[model samples]
Target: MEQASEMGEIGREARHEGGKDEEFRVQPKWRKFLAHVGPGALVAIGFLDPSNLETDMQAGADYKYQLLWVILVGMVFALLIQTLAANLGVKTGKHLAELCREEYPRFVNICLWIIAELAVISDDIPEVLGTAFAFNILLKIPVWAGVILTVFSTLLLLGVQRFGARKLEFIIAAFMFTMAACFFGELSYLRPSAGEVVKGMFVPRLQGKGAAANAIALFGAIITPYNLFLHSALVLSRKTPRSVKSIRAACRYFLIECSLAFVVAFLINVAVVVVAGSICNAGNLSPDDANTCSDLTLQSTPLLLRNVLGRSSSVVYAVALLASGQSTTISCTFAGQVIMQGFLDMRMKNWVRNLITRVIAIAPSLIVSVVSGPSGAGKLIIFSSMVLSFELPFALIPLLKFCNSSKKVGPLKESIYTVVIAWMLSFALIVVNTYFLVWTYVDWLVHNHLPKYANALVSIVVFALMAAYLVFVVYLTFRRDAVATYVPVSERAQAQAEDGTGAQAVAAAAAADHPAPFRKDLADASM
Candidate 1:
């Protein structure tokens, strides 16, 4: 009886310990999720950058809330494309840049590097202008002086990464929230019709003049090119284990975190549009405010919030714009580093690299600001947006091809539904961009100040380049992935090991003919 009683006690202890174990398991699931949160936050900042603000403000001031649907669609597509990048990193232990280097020849790689660098520089133009405009608004500095100041300010922000990527993410995220709070606070005051905002977000319409162009710009701002390289490389910083369950779990957690981050970004974008729409279209709008709305730019966005924030409007708007511009500058710098390191296998200190890109980006901005002042600077932002739109296909085509490659991701290739959706969205983007480019070029040709001979020569060169662009995109789309970087050896070995099969034999066979190494470290590994 004593032995029986002891056994019952033992059973009770076992049950209690089991309960504790279950609780422990459930608790760390969330903790593990927290570990995956920083990368998505970093990527989501790209969505709320100054470029996005420029497009959002224009869309709202010009068409009220009619273009909110564009933001929704663009963000949905951005989420899909970004997750594919993360999946590529997690599954292959390599970022998109590294993969591109391995897959392309030396000449092709050089061309791609130049194209990506141009994309980086073009992206920085708006950040430079937007941040400068913020400084001018707040400190009452000349726009040209403010443009020069942007060169030094971003270097200080980049210093945060010295602590760690997570710390930098925290800093960027804080800036993002600051911008959100400022806009949403203004939004509450304006109180645009909730029904109209809902309809604008769900129902797609491009009724008014220039609405189509604004929609294109809005879409381009949201889906940035450098963001793909940044997201893919950022995932490598997490050090996920090389196991099926761990990889799958990491991908799932990253997606959820990314979705949440985008939701915050989307709301912030909506608030910007709604506030601009509400104030610009108000019956009580002053003539000066009406004139500003008739031609809204970042420099004048503060006027929209004048009645709401009163004398503090410029200060509040400048603060939000500064956060928007500076946060994106930091993100752009990080992306430039990743692009250089990934494609050219070249690495530099963050400040040095940032200074180089910033200097290049500053020249055009300074010239426009000094020559034509704030209006010219605003037009430069739109020009930069168009450049980004044109550059998107180069980065995107390769990513789509890589993600759909069975050899590149082995058993982790994207699903049929995902593939179909990705292609459809991509095709739409390419068509819109091509049509716009051709239309703009023809429009310029028809109304140009150039000599006819010079116009003829320019037209030939431009058409040739456009043709080359389309051909290259077609090549990448149909290109066969000749290399297998992420084989199914790990999965196969784990399965076979349970039945006494040797894992080494499987790894050996998988690695035998592989040109690229199976494991790639972000710091030292070369493709």
Candidate 2:
């Protein structure tokens, strides 16, 4: 342990001095195993985004215990997929975005980056709006003021990462645990029927029109495109030794860590639903809550908590909401950095990136907040999800392809069965999400949901935006980059036995024997 520590310090100082003082040697034993613990915490908090609160709240309110299964499915897959990402990152020195850039072509890379940036901006919009809503409810601050405040608050958090990624993880993890405690306390107080909770979790049923949408929202929150990119890249922050045994151990522990995170996320979801359901399902809902029951917003939830769960519960709920939004902001900033660096190979200071992203995100947020303060938060969430829906194919399609590729991901390659099933599922999800987005946008375009008749000018502008969005989707589905050809391992083995890399003369040769195919396949690779 002392040797590894000394070696790390030596390596750092030597690098700092431009190799002038080379003293440290490579590690005798890799410390990569220690890195698996932090990335899961980051990914876990991804589930707690404010958008998720709405979905979880809806799930519990409408169905009571029936949709606990959403959380179950979410956690199960989050662990399964994130471990794959962590394993890939630890095995390969590069992060997922870097791999994508190395794997795909220029135009394709830029397209993906644009999509990811949009998703990040979309994700940030909610955090901005949610913070505003919380400010409005608790402090009676104007929503516009809250928006400005959130950007500054997040800018301050940008400094926290200066110490290290693990520092950011610990801070975020503490907040997540605090959120869990608050909800778990609520769950205990509510004492929701255990049998019903179990039944809801195990049995999958969509009873109302809202059921399907709520289920979709829950699934969308759990398996987000940004989180996938975020997880893969985050695993690369720590240096892990690349060896068979150590890689395998890292993979195993990551699985455990991710599974645990997912389960905790599940309980939090259950708590949200339980809290909402208890109030909505109460024998005596007040007329105002009952009247607005069909359309609950962030503003509605705390009041419900205060009435049903007590004023203390309301305080806990708001505090947790603040923690949830802030922790999510931490990751949103980190993910933005990875996307920018991976796609562009440009490194900016954390604060610069945070300021740049928050500035862009805050404008649309400010306009919406000022024009439609408290009520607009819900629209902001739906719009964010819609943006995520549009960006889904960019991230999801690449991950599916890369995970299944033998040459790129190696023995860690997803099984043929896993590939087929995962691809089918991913394609179905993208289609469904896209369909919803298109429908929503189209409905807005045609009806103009504003009071009185539609303004032709506004409708025309919306049409243009929606058309551009559709064009982007069509490009993703139909676009083809230069596909890299792969020589099978068996063929490579036969070649090696014959004359590949002049096998007898070369002590280590696979890296040399490998073709330039990964370079050829590079167009679609950016994260």
Candidate 3:
């Protein structure tokens, strides 16, 4: 009777403390949700980056609403993969890069690090060139001068990180919305046929000479390699409550937030395509505008939009492009910092890291801008897209492998349904990307004006490298992970049952660390 009274007294105390906590600590679902918002927004920037904008414009101008389906499908795949990345980080308390370093051998880690660095550099090129193009349009500066200006401009914007990640995310989200407003405003004016846009989104068709190529480029641009790294690392910034329910809630909130971000990106991309299509397909198009549509580039988009936006069209387009470029550049820089720290376990100052990446990205852009002009810069964006296509498998395969491994995520390992769907989709994407890579290489080999011997030599060297690439990919896929970072709850419970003293010790330790309510809950759970 005395023991029962003591237990009842303890229960009453917990209930009283819980009542007080509810008055002060109960938060609306939205309030709790706001904490997990930044990472998804940051990851979404990659989808709206300049390279994506370029692809969207070309799809509309070239194929005229026939490819909106690609963006929809691509975004779905992106959301799935991105959610897995967030879950991995939240459950393991380690980002993808750190996990990769721990999971792979030293030589493999070094190689992966180099590939990741190259991927970042390639991704940054389009952003650099796009910002330069925006500058040339707005300030009447030469593309080379604009390229130089991006160095300083991006660094200044990145200074917001000194305040906090949330500040930077807010700033970038604002810029993304600004870009959306500009495109949607244009979309409102152009008003492409609703039926046609709807049909394009639902029906999958590739009907032209370059339509298949464009579709591949669109997919490659959306599912970026560094983004997987960025998303995983970004979630680590948020401190989730250390409990299964809290962790699962955090992952769900992130998935929702990420879905919303992708929707905005999807709408903006659709707007870009429709705006380009509506203008290009208009019966009233002039001969020069017709020519521009035939070969639409970012530099010519302002001219194309002049029909609606008129006089200040260039200014509006420049502002939108600048926002896209700057926001993406900032995110890429952040991803670089994360990648460096994770792969090599090295941490450099933000400015120093940004400077190194910016310099490497700039050298090629500056040279191309000076020697061959805007056209050269455009070609550089294409090159970067191809590089990303090749790098995607490396980052993506490992993410899948790690997430499916019990040792990595423990009790949070993704379900069999998710695993099956993810791998199938991943396989399809890999096949598409592989086709694009080989096609591009073969097309280059076929078209190059070289002697037979030179062509033969080039083919041998390129094909040899391709063979090595395949071997590396297969190796990463088949290699089993031996490290166990997270212990499953089931195993812990079994351990506790096997040793009552250990269980008591663990419960006592957890109680000491947790609050009264949590302690009571934990005690009940142990019982």
Candidate 3: residue 505 Cα off by (Å): 9.4
Worst 10 residues of 2 by lDDT: 17-26
Best by lDDT: 1
For residues 260-280, could you state the per-residue lDDT of candidate 2 as single tens digits?
Answer: 777777777778887777767
Q: 178-256 in candidate 1: lDDT tens per residue?
A: 6577778788776778899999999999998778788888887888888899889888777464445566878999999
Among all windows of 10 consecutive residues in model 3, the one with the lowest summed lDDT is 518-527
Q: How far is candidate 2 from the true structure (C-alpha RMSD, Å)?
A: 7.9
lDDT of each: 0.79, 0.65, 0.78
Give model 1 RMSD, 1 decimal: 9.0
Residue 218 Cα positional deviation in candidate 1, in Å, after optimal superposition: 1.0
Better of 1 and 3 by lDDT: 1
Greater-TM-score candidate between 2 and 3: 3
Angstrom error at residue 474, model 2? 8.0
The TM-score values for the models, in the order shown, are 0.87, 0.77, 0.86
Candidate 3 Cα misplacement greater than 4 A, ranges: 1-26, 159-172, 489-507, 511-527
Tell me the lDDT of model 1 at 294: 84
